[model samples]
Target: MTITHTKAMRKDNTLLAITHLSQLLHYVTGFGGFIVPLILWLASKNDVEGMDEHGKSIINFQLSMLLYILISIPAILLFGLGILSLIFVGILGFVLPIVNAVKAANGEAPSQFLTIRFIG
Candidate 1:
């Protein structure tokens, strides 16, 4: 590939990886889970090809996870099952983003399971 092509590919890969990994913002900002990814995706989606799709996926997954957490709150009254669901959600939230980030770095599309399509 030409140097220009390589550079562009590198940029795309970086942006895609950021899109996936930005979810970690939740740990720092308490609500950065959606905000950080949304900002990154919005800022880079047009500049980097495929970023729009990846951004949408990330945002949708975050939203879905939030919904799941909200639902789990009520389940807490039912023998504390909500606690288990929250734990599972926490694990998935931490793991899936890393997995997707790796996929992005490898120049593959980010595919998230248990995501709801809120933006698209």
Candidate 2:
């Protein structure tokens, strides 16, 4: 017979909010936005009350923004419309994480605007 000990999950609004805001790492260091939160989430999802949901939202938003930016690159040829999309993506990427960070701090579900359900 074998017994396993599992850590109990707990509610931590501060950690949640920080995870949401960590997406900004991409802007500050040109990377780590996804990596940081991803590591945090994977490390604590089972130990944190809302880490799974919030983490997924963050990942989805990051991925969607990346896809939009990638598409916008070649779109620079289409009369510069890609420029507009790129700007929009940049603004959205910067804004949504902040908004969702506030929400996460308040124990509200993080918003996944324009996010594609890639993980589930």
Candidate 3:
């Protein structure tokens, strides 16, 4: 009886781990396309513990999208200035997410500026 129980527990744990990995897999496998929570829902329907790294990475990924949108506004101010401004922000956006994705894949929490807001 004890041996069977232990095996079942291990199976459950493995299932949970796979689920967590799948949630954050977007950071590793794509151009931040799976950065949204919708993709992470494969593992847990409610929430999964010990996966803050993935959440932080996705948050940073979303912030990069915001940077792209913001730069487009300034890019409209002047043709050359807009192009230069976008190029700068766009580069930062690309680099930051890639770094964060690596950190996330390694199960490390990374700090991303302005991405996490204190609601309380």
lDDT of 2 at 67: 94
Prediction RMSDs, each to the true structure: 5.4, 1.5, 7.5
Query: What are the clashing pairs of model 1?
Result: none
lDDT of 2 by residue, 79-100 (tens): 9999999999999999999999
User: Where does the lowest 10-residue lDDT sum fall in candidate 1?
Assistant: 2-11
Per-prediction TM-score to the true structure, in the order listed? 0.86, 0.93, 0.48
Task: Quote the lDDT for 71 in model 3.
Answer: 63
lDDT of each: 0.86, 0.93, 0.48
- Evaluated against the true structure, the overall lDDT of model 1 is 0.86
Residue-wise C-alpha lDDT for candidate 1, range 9-61, written one tens digit per residue:
22578778877888988876777778888888888776787888889889889
Model 3 ranges off by over 4 Å: 1-37, 41-48, 114-120
TM-score of 3: 0.48
State which candidate has the highest TM-score: 2
**Residues 1-120, model 3: lDDT tens digits:** 355532211112333334334434444666534444435533443345434444444545565556665867767777578777666665655565556545545555544644544211
